[model samples]
Target: MNTNTACELKWGMLCAALIFLLLGACSDKDAIDTRPSYDPSKPVTISRFAPDSGGVNTQMIIYGSNFGSDTSQIKVYINGHLARLIGVNGTALYVLVPSKAGTGEVKVVIGNPAKEVVAAGPFKYIFLPSVSTLAGFTDKDGRTAIVDGPIEKAQFEEPYWLCFDEKKNIYVLEEFRGMRFIDADKTQVSTRFRTGNGLDRPRTLSFNTTYDTLYITNDQGSWTGLSTAVATKADNFTRWTSLIYSLQTNGGAAQPQTGDYFYNSYSNGAIFKWDRVAKVSKELFRIGDVSWEFNIQFAPSGDFAYIVVVNQHYILKANFNRETRQLETPVHFVGGRRSAGYQDGVGIDARFDQPHQGAFDENDNFYVCDIFNHCIRKITPEGVVSTFAGRPRTYGYADGALRDAQFDRPMGIIYDKESGTFYVADQKNRRIRIISTE
Candidate 1:
C-alpha cells in the first residue's frame, strides 16, 4: 500500500459520496406530493347560499377541499338537514340548500373512506337568510301585505312585481314609472335605482338567475303610437343617475322609441328582454293580445325562457343569443286559439286556456295556472301535460281535499315548501290565494 494508492482511494470515495448526495436530493419523492393534507384551520369554503325570491328549495353553491374524486365520501350538513349534492366536480359541489330554521350551523364532514393527509376542520356557513312573506296574507288596512308589514299605501297598485338581486334587495316594478329596490326589512324602497322615465306601463320582470341582469316589460304606456315613439325610463347607467333614457334627451328616436319592439298586446304580447342593467333590449317574441305571456317562467338553468301565450294564443319557449344579440324563432310549446282562462293549478295545453304563472315541483315539473279551465295542469319537461289540480267540475275550496277545489282565475303563483302552501295571485278575484300542496 503506497501513498499514491492511498490518496487515489480517498479521492474516489469522496467523489462517490458527493454523487450519492446529489441523487438523493433529486429523488421523485421530493417532486411528487402523493398524499393530500387537510387543514381545517386554513378554512375551506364548503358552501355558499345567496338571497333568493324568498321561495322554497332555494339553490346554493358549495366548495370543498381534501375531498377525493369519489363524492360519496363527502356529506353536506346544512342546519343538520342533509342536502342532496346535485353535482359534484372534484371538491366543488352544487347543492340545493334545505330551508333554514332547524339549525343555524353548516357542517361539512369527510366520510370515513376519505383519504386525508391532514386534519380537516369544518367551516361555519354564515348563511344570509331571506325574508319575503309578510305577517299575514290579507290586504290589511290597504297599507301592509299579509306577510310583509308596513308597505306604504302608495306602493300598492295593480300589484307591483317583487324580485331580488344578488345583494338581496327586493326590486319593485311599476308600469308607468320604473323599478326600485325594497330593503330586506320590507320597510323602505330605494328610488335611487329607478329605471323608469319614458316607460308606459312597466309590469312584468325576469331577473337573470345567474347574473346582475334584469328584464323589465311595460304592459302599456301613453307614449306608444304610430311613428313618433317614446322610450320608457330605464336606470340611467350612463349617467349613474335617475334620469330617464328617452331619445328626446339623446335625440335618437323619440320620447318612447320602438326599435326592436313590435305591435303587441297591452299585457299580452311582451318584449322579451329589455334589460335595465344592460341598457338594451330586443323582441323576445310576440303574442296576439292581452293576457298573453301569462304563465311565463325561465329555464331551471336560466339558459332559456318560456311564455304561455294566453288570450291571443300560443305557448312557446323563446331562445336568445347574447352574442348575436338576436331573439331567434320561438318554439311552440303549448297553447291553442281556443286556449282560454288562466286561474289556479297547473294549466295544460288541452285542458288550459289562459294560463297565468307557474310553479315547479322538486322534479322541475311545471305546474301551470290553467286559468280558463278552472284547474291546474302539470307539464313535464318533455312537454307532456297533465292535470294536478283546479278541476272545473266538482271543484270546491276544501282542506287538502282533491274535490271541491275552486280557484277564481288563479294568476301569480309561488310555492312555500316550509308550510306546504301554494300562494296564488287570484287576479280576477282581486286577492292572493293559498293552497297547501306539500
Candidate 2:
C-alpha cells in the first residue's frame, strides 16, 4: 500500500476502535443489573445516615443492609412522616426529608409485605414554618355549605370571623350561616347557632370576657339598625339578642381582656364603648371624618388599639386610656390611607389593599387580613410590615408550605397564643386557612 493508502487504513482502524468504545460505553450505561435481587428474609437494617438531621426536602442517605435496589420497595420515614425515596442501592437508600417531619426516629421499611428497621439514632428534623388548612374544604371550586361534625367532615359557607374561648375552643362566625363552634381539640365542629332572626349578615364575632357570650357583627344594610348581636352559652346559643345596635352597617366589635367591649361605626369611624350593664354605648373616639367599614383590635398590652380602616387601606394606632375607657387621637401606624397596593416596608412605606381586620400575638405583633391584596400582613411592634403568608395578587385555595400557599381575599385573622397558629377566614375561598410554626 502507498503512503496515502496506508494513512487511510490506519485512520479507518482508529475510527473503528473509537466506535467500539462508544458502543461499549452505551452498553455499560444501559445494561440491566444482573446482581441477585435482595431477599426480604435477609432482614433490613439501618445502621446510620449522613447529617443525621435536616429540613424539608433535605437529601439524606441510609446506609445498611438488605435495603434492596428497587426504589419502590424501599420506604423511609422520619418522625412518622414518609420521606420521599429518591433512589436506592442494596446498601444505601437516598431520600428527601418530608415536610412536618419533626425530630424523631428514622425508620426504613422494605419489601411488598413490609419489614421495618429503625436507625439507631433519631433524626432531628429542622423545617420551615408552613401554612396549612386547619378547617373547611381545600378545593378551589368555591364550595359553600354549613355542615358540622368531625373536623374532617365539617364545612363552612364563608368563615367571616373567628374568636377563641377561655377553653381555647374556636367560635367561627359564618356569613349568612350564623355561628360554628370548633372544639378545643380541633377534632369536631358544631353549629352553635343557625342564621335568621337577629343573627343576619354576620360579619365579625368575638367572645365576651367570660367567654360564655358570643358577640357578632351583623350589617343591617342601613345607617341605623341592629349591628351587633349576642348569644350566651347559658342558652346553648340557640337564640341571639341584639347586644348593641343603631350604629351603622358593616362594622366590627372587639372585647378586650380588661372586660370591656368596643365596636366601630362603619360609617363615621367612631369607636364606641358598650356598657353591658346599662345596655348602652358611649362614643369613645372618632377617627375624624373617615367613612368606611372598619374593625378594631387591641394590643396584647391593652395600651393601644389598631383600627383597620377597611376601604381606606390603612391601619390607625390610637392610644388607649385605661382610666378614661377611651382611645386617644388616631394616627397612621402602617400603610397609606386610601393608597392601595401591595408593598412591605416600615410605617407609611408599606401599603395594603382594603385591609379589613387584625389580631395580636402575646408579643404585640399585629397581623392584618389585607383583603383585596389576597394576603396576610404582619406588622411588627417596630412598625415593620411584611407578608406573613400567601402570595400578594395571587388568589386560590392551597394548603402547604408558606411559599406555595395562596388565599383569595382573606377577610379575618385571629392568632391563638396557645398554639402560635393564625386562623384565617379565607373569604372568597370560603375556607379557613391556618399558619402555624412547625
Which prediction has the highest lDDT against the true structure?
2
Instruction: Name the candidate that leads on TM-score.
Output: 2
For candidate 1, what is the lDDT? Answer: 0.45
| Model 1 ranges with Cα > 4 A deviation | 1-200, 208-215, 221-296, 320-326, 341-349, 391-405, 415-422, 428-438
Question: Model 2, range 46-113, lDDT digits (tens) per residue?
Answer: 78886677676666767788865666676788889888775665677767777667899999888878
Each candidate's TM vs. the true structure?
0.46, 0.71
Candidate 2 least-lDDT 10 residues: 18-27
lDDT of 1 by residue, 1-438 (tens): 999997687556544544543343343755773334344445444433322122234444444554433346666666576765554444444455554424344456665533223113322333332212321222544433222234442232333344444454545443344544456544554453334343445545444334233445444333342211222225321112222232111011100111222223344354434344664544555544444444345544433455665554445665545465444566767555554543232223454566655766666677666665656666776677766665563333332343345655554555544445455544333333445454
Model 1 sits at a Cα RMSD from the real structure of: 20.4
In model 2, where do residues sit more than 4 Å from their true spots? 1-125, 138-141, 252-255
| All-Cα superposition RMSD per candidate | 20.4, 14.3
Candidate 1 similarity to native, TM-score: 0.46
